[model samples]
Structure formats: structure tokens, C-alpha cells
Target: MEYLPLFIDLKNRPVLVVGGGIVAARKIKILQRVGAMITIIAPTLCTELKKVLFKQNISWIEKKFQPIMLDKVILVIVTTNNAKLNALIYQNAEKRHILINTVDDKNKCSCIFPAIIDRDPILIGISSCGTAPILVRILREKFESLLPKSLGFLSKLAGIWRSRVRQHIVDVVLRRRFWEKIFYNGHIATLIEQGRPEEANKVFKYTLNNDVGNNNKKGNVTLVGAGPGDIGLLTIRGLQVMQQADVILYDYLVNSEILDLARKDANKICVGKRVGDHSMSQKELNQFIVRLAQKGNKVVRLKGGDSFVFGRGGEELEIISKAGISFQVVPGITAGIGVTAYAGIPLTHRKYAHSVVFMTGHNANGDNQVNWAALSDYQRTLIIYMGKINALNIRNNLIIHGRSINTPVAVISRGTYQNQKILIGTLIDLEKLTRIADYPSLLVIGDVVSLHSQMHWFGQKALNYCPTYLIAHSM
Candidate 1:
């Protein structure tokens, strides 16, 4: 982020090089690839620039570094062996507010050349702000091998059919989904590499024609879990469905980075619900998703955590089935498992707890639904979701039902995220833990909670100023 990456059009643009040595020749060769009108300002020419002088559209000025050479030029390059002369030209370009690159000098450089992986129209630039040029070159070579040479053919084909796609698929979202489905799945690329562009065009036309919500088209709905606030926890199938979705209905708990993986032009609507802040009622949302799928639009219901575990996915799918809509469920890493693992708390350790229970703190009827008798077992680890608000109730009920007040407990908030925080205490301090914890937090109550001292790994990266507190709390 230190330098903003840019790809400028240098075709036929006027540019000046203030030296005629090998380094200057290197810059000139790169400029030549972009077809820049080059003017070399130096008293003598090296073997490289002398050979370059034979090329057309290249002008040589047999003179020392002069201030007038930078006038009316789009860019400037200072590659002279004389350090003072290069600095002088750099200062002149800076005064004129023109982009300039002083070779091997980061401070004097207004721009720096990047290691490029060129696949014709598909150009990938790798740079490290001149700090690690060798590392960037290695990365460029890796990308050059990973990306196929036929990539440019696919991009160019998309360009040629862009107007035709727009004409056929009236909806912008549908058109983008059409392209994402083809390119991301590598079907069009394979056809082009096989030298069957006519077949590729036919595939494009067929995809576009079928995207108009016709009655013959039966749309699909995918219930995908986005995982607990981390893009890495998302299932491969979940990411695929998101990329192919024409429309996505995501929850508030879903990570913004996970949502960014969807097709660029896909319609993303927030159906997210907070504790008391409901954007859309679940009843209305269930019906709305079904309606979208019935209309031949591929819809994705993106929920946070596992779709089946307290995510109300079954209720939504039941409604989808009643409406006779085709649906698929892509499971995701539930917070009960993923968040606990990140916090270094194992749900069931044979020496500490032989059994584990997954429960919700808040339900439709408030607090009466929980079976405290079954939950008070000594050898069981309890994982409670949406339990921050009822932490006091849970503490009192478990103690009243024969669970020990001295049992270890932990409250983890925003788990698996960079801002994740963990608070460790005993069941007696559960109310205090709730006061310090945020909403959408998880509660781990059992002897297994004490094992966090030995197993703790992830700490809040933003808490670098309080290292002592972090270590003391984890211990």
C-alpha cells in the first residue's frame, strides 16, 4: 500500500531518458514494448543505446543533461552514472510535477518499474516498493507459469462479445454472472485454447439466451455458510456458489471479505439481523428467497457459521421445498468449532471432559427452554452460542443444577478475526465476563477451559501495547 499501482497508456506518448548507458537502454527497451516516443539526452551512446538508435520512432540528442529536455514530456528517466546530474534532472521533473524514475534511487523516484508477467492483454505487475526487487521477480516468474497463455484470448473474447452479452442479458447482474460462470469454471478458456472460437461464441450466446428468467429455466438456491468471520473458513463449494450466484442474501455476521469473493456485478442484499435490530423478518426472508429462485435467478443464502447448526437453515429449506424450488446446502465451519479452535480450546479432551454440548442461550421463549439438569454434568464441556446476554442466567442455573461454581469458563468474542478477544475466569465470574464481553460472543464452560492456558495461540494483533495483559490473561 506504500505505492499506488497504476497501468498507464504510454503508446505514442513523448518520454525522455537522461542517459545513454546500459541502464538507460534497459528503460528504453521497456518503453519500446509500450511504443513510447523516446528522446535520449546524452553526449555519447553505449553499445546498447547505439543499437536502439537504429530502431524507428527513437530520437537521440547528443548533448549533456539539460533542463529543456523535460519540457512537454509525459515522463522522465534519470539513469546517468553522474549522481549530481541525475539529482538535478529529478529536481527539475519534480518541479514540473512530472513522473520520473531515477534508477536505483528510491528517494528520488516518482515511479519505479515493476516485474511484469505479460500474457499480452493480461499483464500482471509485481512490486515491493523497491524494498525486495528480487522477491517480486520471483513472484512474477511464479505467476507467469500459473497463468495460461490463452488467458488473453479469453479476455479478448469477452471484450468482443460484451455488447452482444449486454444486448441479450438485460439485467446487469445476470450478465456478470454469465461471464463469471464461464471464465471462472475455465470452460471458455479451454475452448479458446483448443482453437474453437466459433464454439466458444456459441457457448456465450447459449448462456446469455438462457439468463432471461424464461419459464423453461429452473433456477437453483444454495444455502451456504460463510463461516465465523473469516474468509479462510469458507468451504470451497460455498465460494463456488457465491461466485456463480446471480443474487446473494447475506447475514450481518457474514464477513465483508467473504462477500467480496462473489461476482463483482452480483446483486448483494443484506438480510442481516442483530440482537434487536432486524433488517428483514426471517419469515419474509424465507419467502423472498424462494420467490427469487422460482423466477429463474440463481440465489445464494449466505449465513455465518454452519447452515444447519442454529442457523435456521432447515426452516428456510422447508419453505423452499414447499414452493417446489431446487435447492442445495453447502456446509461451512461453524463458530462452535472454528472459533474455539482459533482460541485454542478443544471441545472434548479425554482427561478433562469426555462429552460436549452445543446449546443456544436465547431462543423464542427466552430462557426456559434449556435443560439445565442434563447440562449440569461434571464431565461435559458446554459451548453456548448467542450466550453473552444470558451469561448470568447460565451461571446461576448450572450452579443450582449441581454444576460447580469454581468450574473454569471463557468468553470469546469476534472469534477467528484479527480483533478476536478471549476472557478467562471461573463460573463465579461469568457475570463479570458477560459485562466485559461483546454481543455475538461464545461461552465455554467446563474444566477444559483451564487448558486454554497451555493451548492459547491467537492474540489480538491490535493489543501490541498491552503484551503483559495478554500473556497474564491467557495464562
Candidate 2:
């Protein structure tokens, strides 16, 4: 609350800059975009500013700072290195009520530069009151990734349609709801993204006329991958879907904290599945999704890792498709890849493993569908999901099929999380090593497991783990 945040229109207004250095050049470019009439008062201009003085309609007074220069300007920017001269300009500008911003001097600044994310009309400003500039920069970078580049096009299109929409929909609430659907549908945005503006307009008009405003609209289902255990692993699209979800059906592997990303009023249901334990049967879950979508509620089927990778995402998608429900799949970082990296066990290495295969150990009685003979190839790093219970069988069968028992292995549980547990050993002690891990664990088997000793990296555990004992520990 030290400084009030405001966006001032500098269009056609004269703004004075006291320095011609790189910092001044940077600010001048921003002002140029906003159609500001810039005038610089510097004894000598930098090479960049000299180029700008010639190319742009800029006025430069090759003279020292003086009080008379502040008369015509509405705002003053002091990037001058001379402290006494900067203070003189600030005092004079303040007397005339002219907004002044002194570079790197908060006390003399009437305004400060904020980290701005400009998606045209979608402008977001982040500031730390000039206290933590680096933190502000980092936050801005993160926001830059989180926000879509096509947002400007989307906003412009929305602006163009505003009058037409207002004229058609008289009611304020209904109009707001219509805009929400228009934005959330992403059809127009996708068309714009794919460079089909004419088709986008046609669809936009069609959507406006035929579909929206009422609760009778077909609900959407976005299958989001909650990668491994770390919430950061979730994709930007997945986070957006979660925020828009009217109902979220999540699994046991999904971090509970991820559920908080959903809309405040969103209905969250735990349909998590565990081995030999049923929260809601898969059939029941599929039916439930269809039932919810039939009632026009945006449903988000949140699963851990990549939903397509042994997460039974394909099964759910098939059911949704057959039901004629619109669905989107936001692919996640599956545990096989995400967990191995977090545990510093490479799925493929140049010297150890040339290929990697991911599989599931969970199966019903009499299900011998596994191709263990092919999986026994040590050259292909094998990543097994839910293989904790069947560790003994996997270890013995692989060895029985001529695989070396001395092959290195690592069992990672709740990978990418703070309390994640990882035990390392060889195939000889696979079962014993797995016994230390809980559910939602992965088995990484190959010579690449030996690389864990070299590249032991992650958050706390990896950073603090003793590399000396990486000689393969068992239970």
C-alpha cells in the first residue's frame, strides 16, 4: 500500500527522461508503444538512444538538467547517474505535481516500474513495492508461462462481439453467463490459435445463436493428469480445467492439495481406487461422470501421472466418447517418467539402457497377459506401476527368463513429494527393497539404477542423501 497501482495513458502526452543510458532506453521503448511523445535531456546519448532519436519521433535536448525543462511535461523519469541532479529534478517535478520515477531510488520515486505481463488487453502487473525486484521478476516469468499467448486475440474478439451480445441478451446475468461459456468453450480461441479467424467468427456466431446461457448445455469433461505427487508437475492447462470444473472426480494418487485449485463451490468427490479396496468401482465412476455431464456440470476427472499410462484414462475416455459427452485429455507427467527422474534413476541411459518400458502389476486372478519374456531384457529399463505387491513375482520371473539377478533396481514411493521414500538395491533384493515402499510406488530396473549414485538429485532428500552409501541398500 506504499504506492497506489495505476495505469496512466501516455498517448500523445509529453514525457521527459533525464538519462540516455540503457535503462532509459528500455523505458523509452515501453512509452513508444503507448504513443507517448518522448523528450530526453541528456548531455550525451547512448548508441541505442541515438538510433531511437533518428528512427523514432523523439526530441532530445543535448544539455544539462534545468528547471525550465519540467514546465511542459506531465511526468518525469530520472535515470541520471548524478544523485544531486536527480534529486533536483524530483524536487522540481514534485512542486509542479508532475509524476516522477527515479530509477533504483524508491524514496525519490513518485512511481516505480512493475513487472508487467501484457497479453494486450489482458495486462497483469506484479510489484513488490520496490522491495524484492528479483522475486517480482521470477513471479512475472511464472505468470508468463501460465497465461496463454492467444489471450490477446481472444480478448479482441470478445470486445468486437460485446455490442452484438449485449443487444441479443438483454438480461445482465444471462449475458455474463453467455460470455463465460464463450470464453470457457475455447472453440473460438482454438480456431484463432489455429489461424482460422473467419471460421472462428462463424463458430462464434453459431455458438451465440444456438448454444449457451441456459443450464441445458452439454457439460464438458477434462481429464487432467496430476503428475506423480508434486503439484508443480501439473500442466498449466490442467490447472485451468481444475479452476473451471463444476465437479471434480479424483483418484487416490492425486495430491489432496491439488483439489484446492478447483472453484470454491466445485463439488469434489473421492473416487480413488486402491488394490483390493474399492472407493467407487470403475464402472460406477464412468457412469457417474456421464450422469453428471448429462446434467450440464463441467466434470474434471483428476488422475495421477499420465492418465493414459496405466491410469485407466483410456477406459474412461472410451466410455465418455460412447456417451456422446465432450471430453478433453490434459496429459500428465506419468509416474514412470516423473518418479524416476525425481529418484535420480534414469529410465534410459546411453551406456546402461537404450529403451524403457512401462507396465502395471495390478491384475485380477488368472490374468497372465504380461509379456515377461520381453520385459526381462536388461537393456530396456522396466518401470512398473503398482508393482509393490508383485515385486517377488516380477524379480523371480525376470531372473528365471535369463535376466541377471545382479541388475540394479530402485523402488520409489510417493515420488516428487517431501516424504517420498526411495530404496536402492539389485534385482536380488527387489522384494526386500520394495517392502519399505507404500502404495503408488514405481520400480525402476536396469543398469541405469547405478547412475542414481552419480546424479542423486531432487528436493530435500536427494540433496541431503549420502552418495557414499549408494552402493545399493536393502531393507
Candidate 3:
């Protein structure tokens, strides 16, 4: 990391700028917006700078660089054309432990300017550690484009609820979850999109009461699929449950962005299972879900991918059924199809495989007890879940059972989300593939795995182009 990016609160603080040219004028404008008391020191002043000084009542000293100018200043900007003078100022500021920025001279400065995206209460700072200023600017532009223009309005709306939520929701966990849900469930996004300040206010106010009632009613559990890591992949029903939930019990594989969809007044509990880490047993988790629902709070059991597809969702459903609590299930895009689709690999194709098989690598006793001989003879696509740990063993068993070593295999880690990885190999290379791959990966084997290149389309534009083809193929 070349530079640590941070936003310094400059309200009512004194700042010094040592330049009177365009650079100084630009810095002054930004500082003035944040209500910084700016003092400009230079022998000459630009027309814009002079106008700002007169209009904004800013202090201006039409003089050369002086070391004494640094006293009583919170931040200093050396924007003069003289590199030597800027370097001198940086050295002096360093000695005094003062924050200083030398324009375009990162090496000679104590601090560097960051590409900033401001939406009033929502400020995003981006930096490339002083290595790639252009890259940082490009990233800032991309985000700025994606962010709504009315984000400032939405932020102000959220700010209005801060104190009210804190006061009304006594539980810290519930309060945090409530705010997260409000922000994540597209409430704020919708408000910004429609530019509905008044409507947004009303909606926010109504949500507070609704959330409270939802929290106090006869609690029910909804087993929700978090989708394949991407927030956009979540179903409409899944999002609805998240918005109304009083408490969310989430798994390890569930994305944080999905959890952010829950109401700010809800409680968030992590029940994810991690290898080598002590976690609540399946029985304990089931009981916990039942207990939460019995407390008259709407509970959401959020899991990764599809809840029923190797997510131990059946176990949870059984517990909820026996308890006789009101319950529902919101299916998500299962990993087998979701991951392969995103990776451009079709699980079933007319020319490749007519059928697809989804199987678990391990059973209830955590043993690789799959019928290898039968599976070897199956001329179809195979999507294996929880197979990373025993991938080598499965591969060898399949080979011994008459499966060819050349069968294509694709191991996808963290599928359908950013940071997703796709490793393609064959049965013979399974061990090497396992070593290079990370956890939470799925394995796909068969001739269908070779079609990923033509079928892949997980990014923004892929959905528009591929869904038509997929639907037509299915028909």
C-alpha cells in the first residue's frame, strides 16, 4: 500500500495553501466546500482565487513561501510550481508532524490527494497507493457512474433515522441489522432512483413501525438461499424476507451484502460452519432457529447458494416442522447451475450431455460413500458439491471405476461472485487442481465442462445475451 487514504474532517479547521495559481484555486474550492478556514499564501493570485477570496471572505497573503506560514494550521497544501519549495515545505511539515500535500509530488509529500466521490453524508475515497493515480480516477469515475445522483438525499434520509432507531431499538445487534437491511434492500436505492424525498421520508417512517411490529409478532422462519454470492442473484422473495426479518441466522458462505439487506432493527447471528473451527452443531443450530421463532420474532435462516442443495436445509426444515412454527422457503439459484452458468459452463447440452446429476462428495457421516462404479458409467454431466477436500480420492475412484482420465473437470471457487475462479483440468490432474483451488468450490465433470467458453456470461452484459440461448436450449 503506497498511501493510506482517509477523509479528514476540516469543518472549522484552519488550512494553508502555498500557491496562487490554478492548483491553489482548486484546492481552495474543495476546502471551502467543507467549511475549512483557508489561508492562501502566494506572490500572485489567479482571477478565480481573488474572486473566491473576496466572495468567501477567505484570508489571502500576496507573498512568497515563508516557513512561519505553517503555524496554527491543521493542513497545508504546497501547490506552487517550484518543486524545491514544495519539497522544503514537506520536510518542514514532516518535522512538525503536520499533514501536507505537495501537488503531483507524492514522494516529497507527507500525504497525497485521493480521488473522492462525495454524496454529502456518503463520501467514498479511492486511492492506488500513489502508484496509479489514473487508475484511481478511473475507478472513482466507474463508481460515480454506478452511484445515484440523489445519494446525498438518501444519506440525509438515513441520517434522520439514526437517533430514532437507536432510541427505539434497545438491542445493539438489532439496531445494526435494521440499518443494514434498510440500506441493502434497495429502499435507499429506490429513493435515490425516484428522487422522492418526501415519499422516502414517509417510507422510512412507515418502515420503523412496520419493523417493530414485525419483530413483535409470532415469529416464523424462512429458509432463504443467499444465491451464488452475488447480491443481484437473490430472488425477490428472498429480498422481501430479508427486509422484514427480525433476526437473521446466516451461514459462512452467504455474502455480507445479502445480510446487509435485513432491517436495521433486526438481530444478525452467524451460524456458519468453518473447518477446524468450533461451530454450533447441526442439532444446536436447528434448536436455535426454533427458539428464535418461538420468541415471536420473524427469523430468517440465510444460507449460501440454494438452501436445499447440500446446504443442510432439509435438517433445518425438519426441526421447524416438528416445532409447528410458521415457516417458508425461498429458493435461490443453486450452485450446480448458478456457478456453471456464471463460469460459461452448461451442465447439460443436447450435443454434450442430455442429463445432469447433482451429488454430494460426502454423506451424513462425512464419508465419501458415493457409488463410484455406477457414477463412472453414467454418461451425463456431474456436479459435485463439498468435493474439494476429497477431490483426489473421488478422481482416483472414478478412474478405477472405468471413468476416463481425460474427462474434463472444472473447479469453481466462490462461484457467481466477484473473485470467482475457474480451474479446468481432467481426472488425472484432480489432485493438482485441488491443491491450487480454495474452499467453497464446486467440481463439474463431463464433456459439458468443455463448453464453458461459449456459454460463460456472469458479468453485467452476459445475462442479456445468454438467457435467451439457455431458455431456447431448454425448450
Candidate 4:
């Protein structure tokens, strides 16, 4: 983030070096490989630099550094031992907006060089922005050993065949798939490594010809849980499926950071449902998913929390299954579980609660209304999802069913996120306290809510508000 890495074309470009020591000689030799027109400004050259100068064509000033020398230079490398001179050069270069590197001084440099792995047309540059340089060198050495010397030859051959391959395969995705098959099929690269160009060309052409006719490809449909608004809570499998997805249909509950993990070229569609806002109906979504998979797109349906827990994942999967589309599901942490743990209220404790129940507040007065009379036990914990809007209905129903009006309750907002908030109060204050709690909040009721005071461990990152002064004023 501190510095953007760029590969610039310095071929036949003017460059200035401000020292003639061995350190400067090392950098000059690297510049020479890139075909830069290097000019050296020093009183005299060391033995190493003198030998290097004889092997390459370079301009030698044979005098002290001056400000006028920077006029024609595209880049400046100050390898001189004098800190003041390096600083002076950097300041002047900054005014002109020219790139400059001050040998061991990252603070003075506008740009720094990276450790490179050169394979002709393929070049890899690794840098720590001039910090921990030894680590960069270790990485470069490791890559050098792992990469075959024949890679450059393979890349050149692929370049030669690229135009022909594109002409055969019209679609971009199919063309990319074709190249992937070629690289991994153990034919083209292998034949070239064996020094048989004719065999490689024939094999490559035959594979392309056969592939052009097989256009009816099938793609997968994956249901990934975005977790409880926490990127870290997302499973590793969830990340992988997202990266490979060709089209992703995500909900509003998903974390924005999690969506950023998908490939840049992947099509992203928002099919999220808020408290009262629905982007697409459940029936429409199912049909759309089926259509996308039938077209051979890797469609990922990303939902928040566990897909089975109030996420309507099973309903969507039923449609896909009936259509004979290949599908998978990646489970995530549900809000009821993830939020309570973060709020320091356990759903079940041997000493406090024996069992826990999960339900949605959306059905408080609906045709599918829950039986609250059986949930009046003081020892059992009740966690409600989609409960923020119906906090009054939920509280009155529970109280009327013999649950204590004074039962401890906590309304949590943005669970498991960095800015999560927990509002503690009794069942009598549930409606009032929840007024300040943000949307997509969870309501926890039982003796376990009392543990919030003793077990609050989210530290300074979370805000805790009890039904003390704020509720009385807000209500």
C-alpha cells in the first residue's frame, strides 16, 4: 500500500548513477541488462567499476555530481556514501517528479528496486518496499530453484500459438480453459522440453480442433455462507469457490470484504433482502440460478451466516437439483451462535441453561406463528433472528406465556463485526432498549444475559449499552 509496484520500460532510456563504488557498480550491471543508457558521475571509478565499464558502453562524467546532470535523466540512482548528497538529489528529483533511489536509504528514495527472477519474457519482481530485503532475496532464490530453465522456451512457444488458438476458440472463457488444459495436459510443454517442436505443434493443433466442437459445457452452483459479518469467519472452502466463480449472486448481509475475494472479471449481482426490501423473490432467484448453470457459468449464491439457518438455501437447492445442476454448499457461522459467543453470553451452560431454541421474529403474528407457551422455561435460552422489528411482539408473547417479565435480555447489532454493539436490558425493557440497536440484530433472552457483565471480553472494539439512561430518554 505504501508504494505501487510497476514494470516500466527503460530500454534505451537515459539513467544517471551518482557513485563509482562497488555498490554503484552492482546496480549499474542490473541496469545494463535492461538496455538502459547509463551515465556515471564520479571523480574516479573503483577497480570493480572500471572492469564493468570496459564490458559495457556507458557515459562517464569523471567529475563531481552537479544539478545540471539530472536534466536529461529519466531516473536517478544515488549510491554515494554521503547522506547529504543523496538527500539533496532526492529533494531535487521530487520537485521534478522523477523516480529516484538512494542506495540503502529508503526514506530518501522515491522508488526502490525489487529482487528479480528473470526468465526472458517472464519476469518476477519481489520486494518488501526496501524493508526486510533479506526475505526478498530468500524468496527469489527459492523461486529460481523451483522454476524450470525450460519455462522461457515454453512461454515463447505459447506466444507463437496464441493467435491460432484464439482464432479456433471464440469465447474468452473457453479460450482460457483451452490454455489451462494445454498447460496441464502434459503434452505441449513436455514435448518442447524434450526438444521436439513438430510433435508439440501437431498435438496442440489436434487438441484445439477437438475442443472447438465441444461447446456444451456444464458449470457448478455453490452456496457459500458469508458468516456473521466477519471476513475471518468465512470458511477456506468458501473463499476458494468464490475465487473460481464466474457469476456470484450475493445478499446484503454478506460482508463487502468477503465479496472482494472473488475474481475481478467475475459477474457480481446483488440479490439481497433487507428488513422490508427484497431485490429478487425466492422463486425468481432459483430460476435464475438454474439458467446460469445451464449456460456453463460457475454461479455462486453467497448468503450471510449459515445458508440452512433462515437463509432459504434449501429452497434454492431444491430447484437446482430438479434441474439436474451440479451444486454444493459451504456452511458459515450463524448469527445466533456467532453473536452470542462474541457478546459473552453462552447459548447453553450446564449450570444455567439446559437447552437452547432458535426462531425468527418475522413470524410473531404470521400464520406460521410459534407456540410461545412451551418456551416459558427460565432455564432455557431463546435466541431470535429477524427480531429487531418485532421486539415488542416477541417480548409480550413470551411474558404472557409465563416467562418472567424481568428476564435478562440482550439485543446485539452487527454481530461479530468490528463495530458490533450489545444493549443489555430486561424483557420489560426489550422494546425500548432495542430502539437504539441497529438492524439485523439478535435478541437473546434467559439467565445467560446476566453473564454479559461478568464475561464481556470483546474489549474496546465493541460498545456495550445497558437499559440505564439511554432507554429512558429514547423511549
lDDT of 2 by residue, 1-475 (tens): 7888899898999999999899999999999988899999998888898888965658999998889999989989999879999889989999999999999999999988889999999889999998999999999988886676767888898999989988888989888877776554544654564467788788789878877565465676878899998988888878876876789999888998888877899999999977678898889988999999888788999998888988889999999999987677889999888888888787887888899988877641124677777888879998888888888888888887778877877788778998888777778788887776666678888889878767878853432222333444432
Clash statistics: count for each candidate: 0, 0, 10, 0
- After TM-score superposition, the amount by which residue 319's alpha carbon in candidate 1 deviates from its true location, in angstroms, is 0.6
Candidates in order have lDDT scores of: 0.81, 0.82, 0.77, 0.82
Pairs with steric clashes in candidate 1: none
For candidate 4, write residues 175-266 as lDDT tens digits. Answer: 87777645432446545544677877786777777746464555658898888987888876677668767899999989999899889999
lDDT of 1 at 290: 82
Poorest 10 consecutive residues by lDDT, candidate 1 = 461-470
TM-score, ranked from best to worst: 2, 4, 1, 3
What is the C-alpha lDDT profile of model 3 across 322-436, one tens digit per residue?
Answer: 9987677879988897788888887777887888889877651324566776678546888888887777778878888899887777788878877788877766766677678
Error of 4 at 122 (Å): 20
* lDDT of model 4 at position 240: 64
Could you give candidate 1's per-residue lDDT for residues 15-70 as a string of tens digits?
99888888898889999999999999888889988977969779999977778878
Candidate RMSDs in Å, in order, are 11.7, 4.2, 13.5, 12.6
Cα RMSD of predicted structure 1:
11.7
